[model samples]
Target: MNYEHVREVDPAVADALEGEVQRQNDTLAMIASENHVSEAVLEAQGSALTNKYAEGYPGERYYAGCEYADEVEELAIERAKELWGAEHVNVQPHSGTQANQGVYYAMLEPGDKILSLDLNHGGHLSHGHPANFTGQLYEVEQYEVDAETGYIDYDDLRDHAEAFEPDIIVSGYSAYPREVDFEAIQAAADAVDAYHLADIAHITGLVAAGVHANPVGTADFVTGSTHKTIRAGRGGIIMCDEAYADDIDPAVFPGGQGGPLMHNIAGKAVGFKEALEPQFEAYAEQTIENAKALGDQLQERGFSLVSGGTDNHLVLVDLRESHPDTTGKDAEEALEDVGVVLNANTVPGETRSPFNPSGIRAGTPALTTRGFDEGACREVADIIADVIDDYDDADVKAEAAERVQNLTDAHPLYE
Candidate 1:
């Protein structure tokens, strides 16, 4: 928080911050899980609140001199609850994965059955990948996308629910492009008397702005990242019915974590206030529109988009059909060479390893925040396709890089 002293002590860290700002100003950020927070949010994140250590919830702190910290946290909690229409909200979880873990801690015992979507089929790691704590501590049964349609198969999910008899059912993803059917997922959970949890980390902004359907009223627990689409600081939030507030709070505090980051909570308050503004609705709508436009443009250029297209802000490009000889890893590096940033992801039923998957994931939230619309999205798609088409050609890559620089310069991110 005290960058002046930091500069006096070590100029390297100060130089790193300046370099990061320059990098953000120069590059095109297309990663779905990333976004630019408002200056107000950043200010709150780097405020004097960082000096305090409020170790407990409001009206109940273990440390002294927490009155102001309690006020800031209470504002964040109230704003979050109001913004999401949640009965109860906890703004303490450090990340989305930790929020999911808190939900599990509140409800399920060790080795209890958990039904979640497969990671390769758009699910997140906390949804029970074997390498994650969720899978190691619980019995995990995974459902997958429909092979033909590349969408969730409700029948298959129901069948798995009946067979697995899970204690918890998770509905969410990191790379999925289509909107999830939360009502149907809730029904499936109810059919087996399982607790339904929805991780809306990627679409929290859309949900906040009412562009996407709300899952808070349907799911027993909902977890989200304040940073991604919400455009907040790097922290996680959990919302649930008031009846479960006590269990969830304790689960996050004593069960999973200790002292909360009051600085991040202050930033969360500012972000929630921004989301409640009328312009945030327009921003969310434009994000989806830009994504669809980009997807359409890519498809017109003969690129194979997984799930056909997107109903959200992200599109998953299946490189196998577009560039049969090139892996997504190659496409990712090729695009990055041209200043376009995106991640290589695994498509459903992908034969490639996770380390070097066969799909590229891109989104429009950060670009949209930077004032990009349908036309800019189309141009970006063209640049990305051009780079992929010339993956092996150094001359072509150089030309593409120059064009990318022009586009990025024309549309500065922060200015």
Candidate 2:
């Protein structure tokens, strides 16, 4: 990871790359949507495939010298099919957002209604946030989690679906802690003759490992990021039945993007192969267990976790109830000072602004990748709780930073 070859041509860029590697090695990455990929994945992502231009699917590319590109892309698509059990798979979309765009472009016309979860309630910006293209192109209706229980109100979602008569219903989430009921969401979509697009961007690995309930068969379309939880390189994927394959392939390539990022697709193939091994199941299981331990420790320290605790890999802690004076940004900065890197997220019933919300979301996917167990994650949670308890205290921050260093040393990521 030294980038010595890059140093000769561009010392500044090489320095930044080396600095980033060192930063990851030193800090705790608790961000729910992030994970560390294997060196194999890293190498594949930095391959010469980046220079290739394979404009079409395997066996039907527009480019002449696409033999290796076709091979890598085919491997990725096949592995993804095996990982998620979909009839058809597209490994071309540039990102999870683009994956969602591919579905919308294929199945939806402009001004068609979109029913999705509200952004403040753990839903993604691609799932109909006003700033995104989906919100701009379609008439959007939102469903929310129960304010008291912190779970999706499935019945309410059904009611909203019936009322809105949306053309598509979006499920899966970004910061949510509980497992989504994709079947229930599918039922809601079916009741209104709507399409179901489950964006399992955060739980792709969990589902592939059978740690989380899969949405592939139930939803009409399934989309996800290959990076989060999956430990693949940065890319997005789409899966659907054979009937929709024609529409999806074109929608992703010529419609939403031009040439695919073949290097990232190579990384996806390598990571997906790694995930197929038995150890990946253990990793996914430990990820959920670590989240539970982290949430339990946080609660024991008097922090209020949304939904009481987590069933998945993330825990959303509302700082308003635990530390009323501290904003999520304040806690985020303090935790960063102590080497725990997570995000300040908006809770279900948000009272503060989106930029500096009232909640902090943490997860175990990256820590689990670093071979952390429940005990290790509990210790990390204690450090986090200490930071929140004494966010302004320099002595506390110093002590917490020392403890985080100890944990990072024990885990030894990318070493």
Candidate 3:
């Protein structure tokens, strides 16, 4: 695979790369929005196409000598449309936030009202966090999850839509664990005469594999990251009904971004091809199983889970009930010390600031891709609980680190 070729000229950079691989092999990756791509995807991303700068859509580029780039981009767009069953697709935006911005530019004017989920309550920053461009440009109204159930309350969302009279209703989240009822959200938007945009970035693979509800067909516009569960290169895609294709394309191109990353487009094409394989469906299903098993095991070990449990590939662990004195920051550090990687997140209604929240978010997609099953997940949860239980004691941390090393040795990722 020539993976070691980089070491020949720059041993320092090569050592860093090797060290990263070793870290991945030694740690349990549980970040919900992260996954490792296949070698083929990696190869495409690092291919010669990166040298090109085809500034426009396929066959209509601003620059000449883009025949190969045109072919690769066309393949990516076509494969993405077919995989998601969307009427039109634009595989250009550099990331999910950028994709959301493109959608906004396509459909609404600056200062238009947007009703979206609240950030601390599982919503993505692009959905309207005060710090993001979405919030700065748009008049944003945020809806929160029901405090008791930790689930979206459609009635409350409807109330917000009615009061805000928003031009767009955004349905999607970054940390939520339950299945999003797009139909309900759409209906609410319909009642308010607002456009519905579903940002299914985290669950795109499950939707493509038919393991989760497909929002592309129902939403007026659907935006997602190609990486996450889709296993594509790090990029974003915006799909919509054919009626808005022209507007979306222009918004993504000259309106918001310049030339597309042709190499990443090629990698996205490879990812779409992989998603079309029947085995992808099995992998998607197993991801959910592993997540549910992990959630149940953690709950059994006295860790409180938001939304009771997960119906998707990720879970939000509310750390307040489990470790009374330890915050999500403490848990994150302790887990890292034990060679398990996860992110601290804010639970719905959490009082802590975003920098140090009350929850930890974890997922099973990467681990399942590395061949772990439900039993393995159970063991992982037990270890996680043990680490959290003794986060302050140095001896406990050392013992947990040894156990993590043993688990990683047994699993042996990227082999």
Candidate 4:
């Protein structure tokens, strides 16, 4: 993985790149939105196709010398269609957010009503956070999870939709730990004559692997990131019925994004191919098992998990109950000092600011990708409990770091 030519051209950038690889090799990555892509995907992303300007879909490019680019894009589209079982798939959105934007632009008008989950309650900014352009452009209203159960309140969502009469209703989440009921949300959208855009950005691979509920047939529009659970490429995808293909393709291309990143599309093709392999199914199944194990281990340590436990790849720990004095930021920094990486998150009924929220979110996809199993995740949880129990204790952090090093050594990445 040495960037020899990069060093010859730019030593500083090369050092940063090498350091990042070493960092991934050394640390545990529990961040829910992140994963380690395969070397094949990496190679494809770094290929010479990055130089091409493929401004349109596969055979309809605006430029010449695009035959190879057309081949790669076509492969990516077909593989994605196979992976997700969509009538139409657009593989060119730069990110998951842009994919959502494509759906919005395709069907929504300015100031149209949008119904989505609340961000502090496991929603995404692209769904309609005030700081995002979605909120600024649309008339947005939010639904919440059941504060007691920490699950989406579908009945309440219906009530909100009925009252709001939104143009689009969004399902799927970022921090919630349970499997979503896409049909229930679809019903809600249908009752109100609203389009449903299910953003399975975080659980794209889980859905494709058939471990989680798929929204393709249920929802009018489906969007996901290629890199998160899919481990494909660092890009976004949009899926819809053939009825909306014309609207979506133009929305993604001439409306939101310009020329596509053909190299990343090549990476997506390679990754989608890898995901089609039998081993990738095992990997996907194991990822959920690891998350369940991690959550159970955390619970036995007296930690409070949002939604009680996980049915997917991540767990959300409510710090307000178990560690009343410790903010999520406190636990986050302390754990990072010990080489266990995760993020501070807001839990349902959050009382703290979003920046220093009252919860910590952790996932097992990256660890599972590094060959970690249930036992390894339990050990990691024990170390996390140790650090959070005594974050200020330097001796505790030192011992935790030692254990982390041992675990990382046992399960190496990028080699």
Which lDDT tens digits does candidate 3 get at residues 78-110? 899889999899998999989999999999998
Against the unseen true structure, what C-alpha lDDT does each candidate score?
Answer: 0.91, 0.94, 0.91, 0.94
Worst 10 residues of 2 by lDDT: 319-328
Error of 3 at 17 (Å): 1.6
Candidate 4, residues 1-415, lDDT tens digits: the string is 8799999999999999999999999999999999999999999999999899999888788999999999999899989889999999999999999999999999999999999989999999999998999999999999999999998888889999999999999998999899999999999999999999999999999998999989998999999999999999899999999999999999999999899999999999999999998898899999999999999999999999999999999999999989998999999999998899999999999999999999999999999999999999999999999999999999999999999999999988977
- Give all TM-scores, in the order shown: 0.98, 0.99, 0.97, 0.99
lDDT of 1 by residue, 1-415 (tens): 2357768888999888777877887889999999989889999999999999888899999999999999999999998888889999999999999999999999989999999999988999999999999989999999999977889998889989999999999997898899899999999999999999999999999999988888999999999999999898789999999999989999999789999999999999999889889999999999999999999999999998888999999999998887888888888888888789999999988999998999999999999998889998998999899889887788878887787787778877655
Ordering by lDDT: 4, 2, 1, 3
Find the 10 residues in a row with the least total lDDT in model 3.
Answer: 1-10
**Per-residue lDDT of 37 in model 4:** 95
- Model 1: residues >4 Å from true position, as ranges? 1-5
The RMSD of every model to the true structure, in order and in angstroms, is 1.4, 0.6, 1.3, 0.6
Work out candidate 1's RMSD over C-alphas: 1.4
Error of 1 at 98 (Å): 0.6
